[model samples]
Target: MIMQSLRGRLFLGLTAVIVLAGGLGGLLTYQWAFDEAIEMQDSVLIQIGSVLQHGAQSAPAETPLAGVDSDAEVVIRELGTAPRGAVADRQLWGFADGLRTDSLQGRPVRLLLRSRPDGSRFAVAQQTAIRNEIAGELAFRALVPIAALIPCLMLVTALVINRSFQPVKRLAAKLNARQADDLDKLPVENAPRELHPFIASINGLLERIRLMVDQQRRFIADAAHELRTPITALSLQAENLEQLLLSDDGRARLASLRTGMSRTKHLLEQLLALARYEMGRPGKSPLVSLDQVAKDVVAELLPEAVERGVDLGFEIIEPSWVRAELVALAAMIRNLLDNALRFTPRGGHIDLGIYRQGEAAVLQIEDSGPGIAPADMARIFEPFYRGGRPSGDGSGLGLSIVKRIVENLGGTIAIENIQGAGLSGLRVTVELHHECDARATGRQQAPAAVPAES
Candidate 1:
C-alpha cells in the first residue's frame, strides 16, 4: 500500500515524527514546570513559618494569623514548652526547627516548625496532596497550548503538501486532455524546479515518438502512391488480354487474376486513404450540414446497394449542423456507409439517421448483417483487424479511417450489437457538437421521412 501512493507515505511519516517530537517535548516541559512549582511552594511555607516565629509572642496562643487562615490550608498550632499536644504535634516537636514531611491526622502534610523567644513552638503546615495538585495544575496548563498547536501544525502541514502537489495534478490533466496526434512538448514554466527535469524528459520522449510516427506514415503513403501506377497498368494489360481468343480454362484463370488484382487495388486505395487522414490535419472547423453529408454519401453508394439487392435509404434526416471540416465529414459518413453496405447480406436493409439531440448532432447507421463477436468488439476499430468471421471484400481499414476522422472532428463513435426477437445486427452511432442556427429557434425541426431506394 505504501508503494501505491507517495502522498500517503509522506503524510503518515511526517505525522509520526511530529507526534514523537511533540510528546517528548511536552514530557520535558511538564517535568520542569512541576519541579519549579514544588520549589516555589516550599519557599512560601518557609516564609510563613518565619513570620509566625517572630509574631507568635504578641499573638494569642494557638491562634491563626490574620492574613493566613484555615481556608488556605495553613495550620498554625502552638505546642507547650514540653510538647503536650496530639501525637502528630508531639512528633513535630521531636524534630529540630526545620521543614519535614509527616502525617497529620493520618493525612500527609509538609510542616515548617520554629520556636519563639519564650521557648513556645508553632508549626505552619499545608497538605501534601494540595501542594502536588497546584503544581500539577500549573504543569498541565503549560501542556494545553502545546496540545492545541500540534493539531494546527498538522493541518498546516497537510495544506502545504496538497498545495505543493497541485502542479503535478495540473500536468496530468493537460496530458489527458490532449488529442491522439498531439505530441507537443510539456511546458515547464511556473512548475517546481524539482519537476523541471522530469518534464523535460517527457518532452524529449514525445518528440522522438512524433518523429517515428511521421516516418511510418510517410513510408506508407509513399509506398502506396508508387505502387498504384504499376497496379493500374497491370489491370489495363489484363483488360487488353481479355480481347484475345482463348480456351475456356484460360478465360476462367483470367477472371480469377482480375479478382485478385481488384482486391489488391482496393487494399492499396485503403492504405492511401488511411495515411492521408492520419498525416493531414483538418485545418479549420466550418459549420457543415450533417444531414446533407449523409445524404450525399448514401446517393453515391446507392448503386452498389441496388446491385447487391440491399435496401438503403435514410430513415431520419433533420437539418442538423456540426462544426467540422467538410472533407472530414464526408469521409466519415462515406466510410460508415461503405462498411454497412459491404457487411449487409443480399435482400437485407441498411438504415441511416441524422438528427440533433440536445446539444449534439447524431448520425446513426444500422445494417441487417452478422453482428460482431464479443471477443472482436474490443479490437473492431483497430487497423487491419478483420475478425474471425471476416466476410466480403473488406480491406479492414474502413472503420479505422472513420474513427480517425471522427476523432479529428472532435466527435465520438459507438458500436453495439443489436439484439432482439428474431433479429441480430450492428448499430453504429456518432455524435458531434451541434452548431445551432442563429436564424431559427432553439428547437430542431422534426425528422424528414425518406423512402428506401429500390
Candidate 2:
C-alpha cells in the first residue's frame, strides 16, 4: 500500500510508538515477575530449613523413625548429604530427602537427620506440596496484571495520538472545501506554527494569480469594446462607398471613407502593440543605443512635428549603450515623442535628452504644452486611461505602451510638471541601468547625427 498520505504516516508512527512502549513495559514486567518468583522460592527454602532444624532438635533420640514425615523430606536430605563445613546446598533439591516440607503443590513431608555424636537422630517437618503450589501461584499472579494492562494501555495510547492530530485533519478538510476561485487569505489562528508559514505563502501566491487574471480579463473586455467602434465605422464607410459609386459626391465620400479607414488602421496598430507588450512576445532582446533610439524616434516623428509647426530637438548628454530589444526601445521613444509633439502648440519646443546619472542612464523629455493635473498624473500610465480630455487626437495608449516597454527593459519612469518652460508641458524621465562607458578613454568619436526624418 502507498504510505505517503498524512493519515498513513501518522498511523504508522503511532503504531511504532505503541509497540515500543508496550514491549518495553512487558519486558520490565517479565523481569520483575521472574525476580519475584525467585524471591518467593528462596523464602520457602529458608522456611523449610528452619523447620527441619527445629524438628531435628525437638525429636527424642529413641524416636527417630517416629519423627519421619513427608513434609520435611527436603531438609533431612540436605542435612544428611551436606559437606562437613558447607552452610548451603549447591543445587535445588526437592522434597525427596528424609525431611519433608510444605510443597508448592500443597502437600507436606517430614525430614530426619543423624547427629554426629553417637548416631543420634533428629527430625524436620514441612509441607512440600503446599510450598510448590505457593511458588506456582506467585508466578501466575505476577503475570496476570501485566497481561490485563497491555491491551488497555495500547488502546489509550492510540486514542491520544489520534487526538493530537485532529488539528491537521481539520486543516485538510477546510482546504478541500474551498473553491478554485477562492483567493482569500487562510485563517491561521490555531494552526501549527510550523505549518502557518506554508499556508500563508500559498495564499499569497493565490492572491497574485487572482489579480493577474482579473487584469487580463479587464484588458480583453476593454480591447474588444475599443475595437468595435472602428470596425463599425469602417463597415459603414464601405457601405456608403458601395451605395454612391456613380457621382462627384461619391468621390468626396470615398475620400472621407479612406481617411476613416486610415485612422481605424492606426488605432488597430496601436492596439496590437499594446497586446504584444502585455504578452512579452516580441522575441529576444539585444544591445541598443538609447541615444540612437531617441534620434530615430525624433526622425520618424519629424514630419508630424513639421506639419504642426513645432520644433522638435534631441541632445545626448553621455555616450553610452544598453542591452535591450531595439524595437521595443524604439517604440517606447516614439510614443513619448509623439505624445510630446501632439500636446505642444505650434512654435512650441520639445526637448529630448539622454544622460548618465551615477549608475543609471536617464532619458528626460520636456515639452512646452499644458501639463497634466496632479490627480491625473498618478494613473497616466494605466492602459486606455486618458488625462481628462487630451488636447489633440490620441488613443490614450501611448504612455501605457511606454510604461510596459520600460518595465520590460528593467527601467523606471517618472513624470512631473515643468513650471517655467513657457508652455505648461510635462517632463517625463526614464531611468535605465547604466551600461559600461564606451568613451572612458576621453578620445571617443561622436555618433553621426540622425535626421529628424528617416
Candidate 3:
C-alpha cells in the first residue's frame, strides 16, 4: 500500500533522507567543533605558560591556578631541575620544554613544561577529562540548532508533499464518485503540469468507453427492431396454422410454439425498452401522478393476474405526485407490477400503494410469493443476474430495465421480505422526490378501482 501511493512513498523517502543526512551532518559537525575547541584550549594553555615564564604570576602555591579563569581547569606547578622534591614532581621535571601528555596524581593531564629564565622548570597542566568536558559542551551546544531544525524540516517536508499531491487525491475522488455509466472526460484545467498528459490519456479512454457504450445500446435497439418484423410475421403465420390444426398432438405442439413465440416477443420488447432507457431519456421532467401511473400498470396486467387466480389491487391510493417523466415512470411501475404478478402463486394477493414519505412520494408493491434469497438481494438489480434459483420465466432483463428507468427518473427502489405483512413475500418500495403538480385539483375520489379485499 505504501508503494502504491506516490505521496506516501515520497514522504517516507524524503523523511528518511532528512533524518539520515541530519544525523550524519550533526555528528560530523560536533566532531569538527570539538577538535577546534580543543585546539583553542591548547592555545590558551600555551599563552598562559608563556606569560608565567615572563614572571606573570607566582605559582608555587598549594591550590591549582587560583587567579586564572575559574572554568579553565589548569594547574601550574613549580619544579626544579634538581629533581629533588617528591618523586612525582621529579618525574614531571624530567620532561623537556614543550607540551606533552603526562600523568599528575595518577590521572591523565595535558602538561606544558618550560625552563624559566633562571633555569627553573615549571609545568602548566590540565586534566584530560576536564578539557574533553569543555570541548564536548561547546560541541553539543553547536549541535542544538541543527537538531532543532531537523524536526522543522520534517514538518515542512510533510506540508509540501501533501500540497503537491492534492491534485492526485482530488482526481482519485472524482473518479471514485463517478457513476459507472458516466463516461465524461476528466477535467485538466488547474491540474499540475506533470499530470496534464495523464489527464489527457484518461479523457481519451473515457471517449472510447462512451463510444463503446453508445454502440452497444444502439446495437440492442437495432437488433430488437430487426427481429420484431419477422417475429410478428411468424406470429401471424402461427395463428393461421392454429386455424387448420388437425390433431391434438399437433395442436399441443402449436401451442408450445406460440408460447415460445410470445416469450421471445416479450424478451425483444424488454431489450428494446432497456436499450431505449440506457441511451438516455426525458430531457426535462414534469409533474407525474405516481398513484395514477401505478394504477394504470396494475390495470393493464389485471387480466393476467385474474387468469392466474391472483388478487391484484391497490391497498393505499393517496394523491401523491412526483417530478419525473411520465413514460419513464410508467415503465418503472409496469415492470414492478409485471414481476409481482408473475411470481405470485394462484389465489395469492398483491398490493400496490402510493403515499407521501418524508419529502418523497413512495410507491410500494408487495406480493404474496417467496421472497428473494438472502444472498441474492444485493445483486437483484444487476442485468441478467438470475439468482441461484430463478422461479419464473423471464428474459432476466425486466428488473434491469426497471432499475435503469428508476435511476434515470431520479428515484430509488428497495426490495425486502414482507416480514409481518401476513405473507412470506417480497415487497418493493420506490421513493421519488415529491412535487404536488396540482394541489388545487383535489383528489377526493377514493380509489378509481379498489377491489373488495381493500
Candidate 4:
C-alpha cells in the first residue's frame, strides 16, 4: 500500500539511500580514524624508545606511576636488565628490540624494548586499554556529522517531492469540482511540461465524446420531427373510421388500433422531449414559479381526472419559485400528475403539496393506488421500462422524461412507496433550488391550498 503513492515510494527509496550511505560512510570513517590514531600512538612509542636507546636508562624499583588511567595517560614503564621472575617480564626479554603486545604485571600493554649504550636493556611499555580509549574518542567524533545529516536530508527530500507533485493534485481537484454539464476541455498551459501530451490526449477524447452526444441528440430529434406528420395523418384517418358504419367487433378493433397509435405518438413526443433537454438548451429567463406550474398542470389535468373518477386536490400551496425553464417545468409537473391519475383507481385520491423548504421549492404528490413494487423502483426511471405493476396506456417514458427534465434543471426527484395509513400508494417528491423570490417580481406567484377542479 505504501508503494502505491508516488510520494511514498520516492520518499522511502531516497530515505533508504541516504540512510545506507550515511551508515556505511560512518562505519568506514570510524575504522580509518581509529587506525590512524593507533598508528600515531605507535609512532609516539617508537620515538620514546629511540630516545632511550641513545641514553642510559634505569629501573624504578618499588614505585608505581599513579593517576595515569584517570587522565587517559599512557602507562610508560621501564624494565631494566635484571633476572626476570615474572612470566610477562621473561616474555618481554625474549622479544627483539621493537614494539610488540605483551603482558606487563598480568595486564595487557604495548612494549617497545631498546638496549642503551651502558649495556643495560630497557623496555618502554604502555597499557593497550588507555591507547584504545583515546582512539575510540577520536573515531566517534569523526562519525557525528554523518549520523546527524541523514535525517536532515530525509526531511528536505520529502518537502521537495511534495512541492513537485502539487501540479497533479491541482489538476485532480479541478476535475473533481466540475459540474456534470460542464464539458469544457481542461487548460494545459498552466500544467507541468511533462503532462502536456497526456492533457492533449484527454482533450481529444473529450471532443470525441462531445461530438458523439451531439449526434445522438440530433438523431432523435430529427427522427421525431420526420415522424410527426405521418402520425398526425394516421390519427386523422383513424378518426375518420370512427365516423363510418361498421360491425361491433370491427369498432372494438378500431378502438384498439387508435389507442396503440396514440401511445406511439406520445412515445415519440417523449423521445423528442428527452432529446431537447439533452442538447442542454436551458431558457435564458430562468425565474419561474414552481407553484404556478403545478397549479396550471392540475387545472389542465383535472378534467381527465374527473373522467377517470379520481379525486385530485392540493394539500398545501405556497409562493415557491425556482430558476427553471417554463415549458420544461410544466412538462415535469404534468407527467407527475398524469402518472398519479393513470394508476389511481376510480374514486381514489391524490394529494399535492407545494411549499418552500429552506433554499428549495418542494413539490410532493401522493396517490392512493396500488403502488409500484419495491423491486422495480430502481428501474422506474429508465426509458421505456415498464414495471411489474399494471401500467395502463403508457409508453413508460413519462418518468424518464420527468427525470431528464429534473436533472437538466439541477433538481432532485425521489419516489417511494407510502407506508402506514392503510393505503397502497406512491409518493413522489421534487425539490428545486430557488434563485430569487417571486414577490420581488410582483407576479403574484400562487395562493395557498386552492380547491381542485371537480
**Candidate 1 residue-wise lDDT, 24-107, digit = tens:** 999999999999988887888888777777764445445555675344466677776887757877887887888888887789
RMSD of 2: 13.1
For model 4 the TM-score comes to 0.75
The residue ranges of model 1 lying beyond 4 angstroms of the native Cα positions read: 1-20, 50-197, 280-282, 438-454
Model 3 Cα displacement at 370 (Å)? 2.6
Off by over 4 Å in 2: 1-256, 281-284, 421-423, 437-454
RMSD of candidate 1 to the truth, in angstroms, is 6.6
| Cα RMSD for candidates in order | 6.6, 13.1, 6.2, 6.4
Give all candidates' CA lDDT scores: 0.82, 0.66, 0.83, 0.81
Give per-model TM-scores. 0.74, 0.48, 0.75, 0.75
Model 3 / residue 97 / CA error / Å: 13
lDDT of 4 by residue, 245-313 (tens): 989999999999999899888888888887887787645555777877788889888999999999998
Instruction: Estimate candidate 3's alpha-carbon lDDT, on a 0 to 1 scale.
Output: 0.83
Cα displacement (Å) at residue 34, model 4: 1.6
Q: Considering lDDT, which of the candidate structures 1 and 3 is the better prediction for this target? A: 3
Error of 3 at 334 (Å): 1.4
| Best-fitting candidate, scored by lDDT | 3
lDDT of 2 by residue, 129-170 (tens): 544455556656776766677667667766776787787788
